[model samples]
Target chain A: MINNEVTKLLNMTYPVIQAPMAGGVTTSELVAAVADNGGLGMMGAGYMTSSQIREQIREIQQLTEGPFGINLFVPNEFHVSEQEVELASNRLQPIREQLDLQQKEQVDIPNFDKVSESFQQQIEVVIEEKIPFCSFTFGIPSKEIIEELKQHHIILIGTATTVKEAVENEKAGMDMVVVQGCEAGGHRGNFLSGDQESLIGLMALIPQVVDNVSIPVIAAGGIMDGRGLMAALCLGAQCVQMGTAFLNCEESGAHASHKEAILHAAEDETVLTRSFSGKWARGLKNDYINEMHEDESLFPAFPVQNKLSQDIRKAAAAQNKTAFMSLWSGQSPRLAKKQCVESLMEHIISETRKIGRKV
Target chain B: MINNEVTKLLNMTYPVIQAPMAGGVTTSELVAAVADNGGLGMMGAGYMTSSQIREQIREIQQLTEGPFGINLFVPNEFHVSEQEVELASNRLQPIREQLDLQQKEQVDIPNFDKVSESFQQQIEVVIEEKIPFCSFTFGIPSKEIIEELKQHHIILIGTATTVKEAVENEKAGMDMVVVQGCEAGGHRGNFLSGDQESLIGLMALIPQVVDNVSIPVIAAGGIMDGRGLMAALCLGAQCVQMGTAFLNCEESGAHASHKEAILHAAEDETVLTRSFSGKWARGLKNDYINEMHEDESLFPAFPVQNKLSQDIRKAAAAQNKTAFMSLWSGQSPRLAKKQCVESLMEHIISETRKIGRKV
Candidate 1:
């Protein structure tokens, strides 16, 4: 069996990682379960506050005394004009009122002005808790912070949507990099260019990155089973990081209907739409995307648009209506299976071992 | 060395086939060159009349006694209301005048009503000429036509953009099916479902098709060179049909500027746009797609819009301007090379063999 290089770095038996899915998807239970199964489990700490991150870390430690990682989003400081945000908010008001979603109290969208303060606090917690693994997405982290993390013996990983980002990550001394393909779900981790321009699929991404950089490479996007694992290895990946595969797992934090939507998604049904969030994310087509897609100029840049749609998405999920929910999934969600994390891990490992020898 | 199944079936040395590209790209020289190199070459006859097909067949026969295939576009009959056609015409008036392309005499757009007559004439030419191999795309051909070709000892292949379409091809008695992933360039092979819903990528397509159908599967889309050839083999495809890789070949009929565009296209530059043609096609982003994309409602269905934009496309190509041309490409244009067809074929075969042994 090929004991991939990333497994040694992540302190895992199998070269498989449960992709950290932000926006209320990955939970402490899910992370603990994945780690307990002898794979790298990660907390999606990008959307969490310092307190929430601390609580989740302790809860994960309580459930499983195994190594795990936390994923954070690098700061992308950009502002949507007040006129644009106001226009976007006004346009979404009809959808919000029609769904009667305003009644529910909402969590504040993270303010970009205070983003650095919160991010610093979160990084401090990772150091204080002696977190062993940490990954960042969206953009390259500052060199000083990376060195600080390295001093604490933290194995740093970076998410890249393009080869340039991967090279930058390597220059920043990341131990590894997750190459997120265009087929990946959620917001793209593009920094050097427009996320749309960085749509390099994993099949083309892995080998090129391997050829250019010395660091271990992790493949992500549309990887759902052992076949995907074997293919990624064939493409020269050190490991495979899968998010869509675990979306339906029993320990996953996905709402029942969100999980159902993922289970029922067809291979080609999910599309990159900015209607749900200001940033491009792959999700199953819903009325929200269709209705607001006519005039994309009406939507503000991400975070603002992501924030405005949050309440409607929450309401859609609460009522089990997919009409407005951001059913984030990879391109091949049809391959998803509902099982426990352990069972999913077992099948992937066995299948890879079975097929890995033949190739 | 792995002797791929399609190679044995087609009496070729390598499991590579030149994808038949219509619209003035694939030439008799390219086809003969590929066949001469021990790879299967295909004549794209979907855009040619019976006499043109006969002349090209004779030209190919003279150049290489080795077998080559002819690809036809299955007649998809649908009436476009005159109003829709007029709206499409009106929308292009501004683009047409801006490019000063009105000097060229326009060929009458094929009347959908007379489609069967022309298709019948083409098939009759195929039969009378005793063509050895034939393939169909766009939709399923009639049983009588397939039976007729089979009686002539012609090996038949059908194009499918999804597994369901692949199964349908098998049921219709095609010898094999080309499983086209969304990553493929040119016009999509979608018929059963809307092309948008048929955007399944190659990584997810090849394995599922191989599992579901007993017939040999020829994988297409995003396959650039020998590494792609090896990957398709690992995915259980019997062979690969690559179009983008050959777009820049010296023997190809693509304009020099088109070749340059394909060579320079970024990973995410190509997108599915119906602006050029009524049907969704992947190509480099140009002004035609960008300006016309906003009011796609003003466009008519395939062949019509495909025909309407011909003058503008021709003008743009003549001027060496990318703003109005359809630089058809896939997601991996960065891997394309500008070489003679013979050199490209040699490189691909050698690379596949080298990588195939290692994998």
Candidate 2:
């Protein structure tokens, strides 16, 4: 039997959650589509400003009265001195030359102050709007912030890469923890402090997380179908969240080329790289990633590097050259079906039902 | 406690098996090492003849009294008419020009009759020697042959890619079924009749096969450590078989370059291609595979293409050029440790124990 906390929190017949894919792929229409089809839809407010987040929430609220979630990127503000930026920039000189850009240009460093602004503003908006469900990635938020949010009756969910991280999330006052495997696309929610990152994939990560944490776990990464959903549930996850599968739906705001790439991708084509942004993320292999990998020294710090590559990425997307665009997708992107969001959700539910019946 | 049938059938303290990584990587020494460590070590017979298989089995037998298994590839004998070969040859003319080869060279189709001859002689040896376990890949053998092997008290293990294939293996009297997921390296075990090739990964495939078939299932592909081992056990698998992890052990016969490549590989570096042998197989991305993908017409039929590339592969290996070799490995190759086989097995057991303690 399903746990009552999850049942009440998700407001869904099945404990299936659509992962909030930020930066234009997940739209109000997509979220509402899943919500209307009896699964929790998530609005990704990771990159959006407070005003934009509020507007998007209003749009989703108008479409569906059922419960939904909004995902945030818990910012990490590590200071990078100018000397560090210059050193990293010098390493990227070859790439600049390849792009016909002038060398000796001043290296830009991102202001960590922006993180505090984003978090404070987003939290205020969430409190005012009384958003029922909220989830965070990258790292867990402050204990006080979580306490304040919980005071407003908001359910707090945290994302984790390792079992230790999952346990930490539960201890940090999160109502549930999301076990994000290395197979997951986009920025890695690696909160585990270490010399080198430990990547525990979904199959190995889930059961351990379930066993270690006292809280409910929402399994994410590489879950694309009913079989995956059922397997996650059987592995002791209270729910499953999928991003890549939902990214290809018609209601999604992903670019046409991005959708096309997802539809035609093979199983092993996706790769995880820190080239796209300063932090590690998974996406389809492209010339930009290949070039960055070849000239690793030239890349700058995280948010700054991401900002610098914005123009080239925009130009590539406009030109329909997928070879340069960031095609973020998970390992099971090939299993994604290009159907209406509602129909896809229905298919998932039906498949899960079939599996349950057999069991 | 572990199942009695698996222990009795495999002649091991535990039912866990190490996959045979043939083509010299899986050495007699490595097989003996695993058997000595109390796990069933398999010798890959994919590229070997009856004589080579006999020699390897004898070598392993001489080193360890514990049980081991032999893997055979069911020849894909779909006949391409002479005209088809001529047409394929004509299409490959440009590739010949690119290589500066003479234009009108004769193309010889490899004799696939050797597949049956090899298997027949190998079966006689297995029966005479009372080999404890034998597994088939690519597809299952005939019912009469499987029955004959079962009569001799030899365990018959059949590999399957889908639920339908697992059901078929069960009906054909296989003692157990190995669920090979898309995460598996080397040639895909897709039969000609099953046109629908579902790329369900290990996590999704293992449980589905367990639920669909009554026979005990062994999970293969992408499992490198004890965490993977425990997860498979929790998902209802009786045992786990790993290939890539064992490919880098001191006892393995893999070339230095190949071993180094596997050790240096990232989780996302592997890809599946049919360019190597005209059959879909997974390997590390290299110049030869990348070039062939860019020039698809150069690829011919199975054994013919495999034979034609032999000289180039051998030349590349002799010169220690990695770009031309087939570096077949799973996604978890990066996690592979360069240690002795017994120490590696002990490490895996200790890791599993650590995870078990945490749980």
TM-score winner: 1
Model 1 lDDT tens row, B1-359: 24756788887888888899997787989988889888889988888999999999998889998768989999888667767766777788888887876744544776776877888889989999988778898988899998988899889999998778998999999999999887788898899966666877677777767778999999888777777776676667888898988778999899888899887766667877888877788888888888888897568887888887788887888888888888898877778888998889888877765654554
lDDT (Cα, tens digit) per residue for candidate 2, span A1-359: 23345766768877778898878877899888888887888988887889999998999999988778899988777666676666666655554555555664453455778777788899889989989889998888888899899999998999987666887898899999888866677777886643123344566456657667899999887777776766566555778888888888899888888889978875456766777667778788777778787645455556766766665566667777787778998766657678888888888777765644544
Report, for every candidate in turn, its global Cα lDDT versus the true structure: 0.82, 0.74
Candidate 1, residue B68: lDDT: 89
Candidate 1 residue runs with Cα over 4 Å from true position: A80-109, A167-173, A207-214, A287-300, A315-318, A322-324, B80-106, B287-297, B315-324, B353-358
- Segments in model 2 whose C-alpha atoms lie over 4 Å from true places: A1-68, A72-201, A204-359, B1-4, B81-108, B192-196
Give TM per candidate.
0.90, 0.61
